[model samples]
Target chain A: MARIDLVDLAHAYRPNPTTDADYALRPMNTSWRQGGAYALLGPSGCGKTTLLNIISGLVVPSRGHVLFDGVDVTRLATEKRNIAQVFQFPVIYDTMTVRENLAFPLRNRGMPAAAVAARVGEIAELLDLNVDLDRRARALTPDAKQKISLGRGLVRSDVAAILFDEPLTVIDPALKWELRSKLKALHRALDLTMIYVTHDQTEALTFADTVVVMHDGAIVQMGRPNELFERPEHTFVGHFIGSPGMNVLPAKVEGRTADVGGVPIALGRSYSAIPPGRKIEIGIRPEYVRLSSGEGVPVRVERIDDLGRIRFAKVRLGDARLSVVAPPGVRLEDDRSRVSFDPAQIHVYADSRRIEGDA
Target chain B: MDKPINNAAWFLILPAFAIVLFNAVIPMMTVVNYSVQDSFGNNQFFWNGLGWFQELLDPSSELGGRFFASLGRSALFSAIVLAVQVPLGIAVALSMPRSGIALALCLVFIAMPLLIPWNVVGTMWQLYSRSDIGLLGWTVNAIGIPFNYTNSVLAAWTVLVLMDTWHWTGLIALLCYAGLKSIPDAYYQAARIDGASRWAVFTRIELPKLRSVLLIGVLLRFMDSFMIYTEPFVVTGGGPGSVTTFLSIDLVKIALGQFDLGKAGAMSIVYTLIILAVCWVFYTVMVTPENKGARE
Candidate 1:
């Protein structure tokens, strides 16, 4: 395994990109530590796959260097880079048995027959494919085929990293959880630096130690799952991560108070040095915003979603809509209720980017 | 709920059935009628009752000996054509550019020969291989190989095979190209990641993916070449001797040239049955294993 570094890496499918919009992946520098599991999480067309492809050497970046363990491999072919990639769809040699499918990479590298067999046996056992080892790959279900694809990558011990590009896309939903857990177990057992690209937030949060949240061709935040949940560096991350996502509402901030549509809300920290003529907003998680009968900012309850164990109130304060967690014992007599935000959980934003305030 | 039975739906296909009856079934019945009777001129037929079929099947009889010889020749020609065309077509397909203006140009060029009329192809090759005025025969003879298709059986066979290859290898190549196109880019990317060699990629991935399309190409080429008559008849006239007299040519010579309707009809039935049997066997052998695996 090797540490992969992207030094000012950027890519554009077009000839010469002049604007940020022209680039598929914006210029950025980041390092993935060896033996760490990282997930590149974003929505469709968010350049997560582009970044993963760049790391795998499938697409050469329009600018910048890819350094694997501090050696420049920017122009290297995928085979020479010692990287393995499992694509969105399972790719297997249909004519070959599962044993031969797993053995392919090892044999291609000229590994001895005994060693190939041993490695194949190990991988088949690890993937629970030992029983179907002699069966042709064409006859297997999609999940089994995907397991063989993963086993092919795992059988080779010298791979620098294993990249997964939404590899569970074609799997049945019931099997997605099982295969996902199996992958996490594989990462722990093999200790290989794995980069998984996915659009699903749950998959990313569950699989990676560090999740890199991307939006509009740029990485918005790179942190642990909880770090992303608690503090989003950019407004996009705040709006993209959580289940209902963090609520971002336009407001006017001055000193230790913010005004949302003429309704004043208290802030825990002061932002006296706020820049002139910029879009100001405040973000808070629905979990931290409690709906109650106590004295707070008055809101009109639009609807209440009863989610089995908990309920969330979709409320409107003046003109701004917000989602607030409704307390289990509290009941709204009418469509009106009071919603309070925990001061510490409130984050201030300027021009769609988070800004620090003096405590 | 009980399902509605729709027996009336069968009437909807009557138009198609009528078309087939007129175009195929009626003509085949006439041939069958001719096969079972002896006919002299004036459309007068007498009951022959398997006399022609029995004679055609007996190798000691004149018609039987001629029929067997021509059948063997046609089968051999088909085998040679398949052996040469399939691999060459695959190679051409593999070498084609994946995309861009060049790919469009290559597709059009490969499709040119297939677009020509069959009789036109026969006539073109007939003139193109003439020793006196043709470029191919004249150039070969100029290069110190005494090649004349009219007089030499080997030369005639070579010309016939080459003409057929030139006229039809494009069909196989185009089919193979289409098959190759249907393969996802992920397979090649995965193969590269696996460090597979070029030959390994072709054999393990491409060839297996191409099996279904190649089956279609083989069957089409086999039936077309097995029933081949026009080009060889145009070029050799089954000549110098009976060297290139394939089944169709021999049958035509009997039915039209000599007007022996009974013998010709029997030969035609046997020839068609042979083709149908071979196709059935080939299709079963190739498709059954994969279908069995699929069912499991």
Candidate 2:
């Protein structure tokens, strides 16, 4: 695995950036290991694509360096970066046949003709495009064109890394899973360094080994997919990376006891540092909260949505509307219900920053 | 994509058909009528079946020499215009900025000459090429050379070719620009990844994609140059022993100036047929079966 280091990389499209707020990508340092499949996940207008472009050398960083294998490539053009990129839309040459589209890069690099054909043959088969090798790219469906685009990047086995920029955004939803699975399989088989950028959490979680969560222009957190799901370091990370997102409630804290909406909540684990502050908020995933017939915080259940596999209890705890996921076997009770949460599953925050003290 | 064919489609299409009939088909029919019948005065007419067509096609007649010479001249003029314009337009389009105010500025400047009325373009060049008052002719005359376009075959051809280029190159450039603009940023990305040179990117990604527009541009330029008039008439008046006389000039000379309506009509039909035939050949050869739906 090659080590990629970004040393204080910052970018601003404007001529003069007067402050950190002016930067489109806030200056930061981070490294991704070689052979790691990492996803940069964030909403639109966030710096995920910007960061991906920076790494791919499509955009020169306004400040600092991008080191690949400990060599600075910050000033290098994208052509010299040796990185493959799949764009949001399929970019295969429409005039070329499916095989020609896949073989273009290899032929450009002066690969032997036999080898180019052999590799194109392999990639086409992997993408299930073998039968259409002789068919012109123009005659294919949108998904087929995308497969050619994918194969064009992957056909060159010598690329240092593959950078995917929302490659599946144009795909129909039904085909998204099939393509994602193909990408995941390709990554496993090739063991190439791949960096994917997407706003969809399911895509990010399914394809990448490590997930990098970004907000505004800065990276909020980076960890394994399960690590991100289980223990998000930043409040934005928890909120941005999950379905229905994590429910955040304003809270107050002192010593061992955490008061959320002026109701006492227990913490099973202790922390060395939770700074007492104003603007504190409590974060919890909707699936983590439990609604049972046991004694706990009293709440009035306003609505229950019974989805096929689970039920969502939209409960009123004081002025807050909170939802708890019930497993398939349990039926949610009346308007008045008691809601309880696993104390160890709790993550408390103060002033938008996660409290380090008690879980 | 399927729709049932209905007679109601004719109701929707009738106005369009009427417009074409009024504007194009009727004029063509008039040319056909004149081709067969002789016109003596405003009211008198006589049937001269194939009489003028025979004379125009005969090597012994002056009409034959003029017809052949004009055909050769028109072909050469069209060839030179295409050779000069398409590449020049593509180059200008390539060199322009891709976005922002700079792109708008380039577009406005390129579009400036195309907006000038055709006859105004002819008039402008007419004045600009005069030995007495025109700057270019005056400068040439001061350099100790006679620079009268009305009398010099070289000067006449230069003025006509340059004027046509100046007036119409913008159209080609705009068309090529549209073709260039429609290319997704992705192909460039793929090229960049492929380590393609600038020339390679242009040839492999840009030019092949521009094939359809190039086809249109060439056909359009050919049709326009072959039928060209007005500008040459204003500037050279087909002088200097008819060195710059294209077929349209001779057609106008025959029908209107000499009142040889039958021969002129026959020549006009022949000229139109020649233009249609050449353009059809170009279109078929350049853009037929192989490249149909070549681009998605």
Question: Best lDDT goes to which candidate?
Answer: 1
List clashing residue pairs in candidate 2: A271-A357
The most accurate candidate by DockQ is 1
Q: Which regions of candidate 1 fall more than 4 Å away from where they truly are?
A: A329-333, B3-12
**Clash tally, candidates in order:** 0, 1
lDDT of 2 by residue, A247-343 (tens): 7787665555667778987765665465544577777787888876576888887777877666787888888888778545445455445788777
User: How accurately is candidate 1 docked according to DockQ?
Assistant: 0.77
Candidate 1: RMSD to truth? 1.7
TM-score of each: 0.97, 0.92
- Model 2 chain A is weakest, by summed lDDT over 10 consecutive residues, at A327-336
Best by TM-score: 1
Q: In DockQ, how does model 2 score against the reference complex?
A: 0.52
Provide the fnat value for model 1, as a fraction from 0 to 1. Answer: 0.79
lDDT of 1 by residue, B10-39 (tens): 999999999999999999999999999999
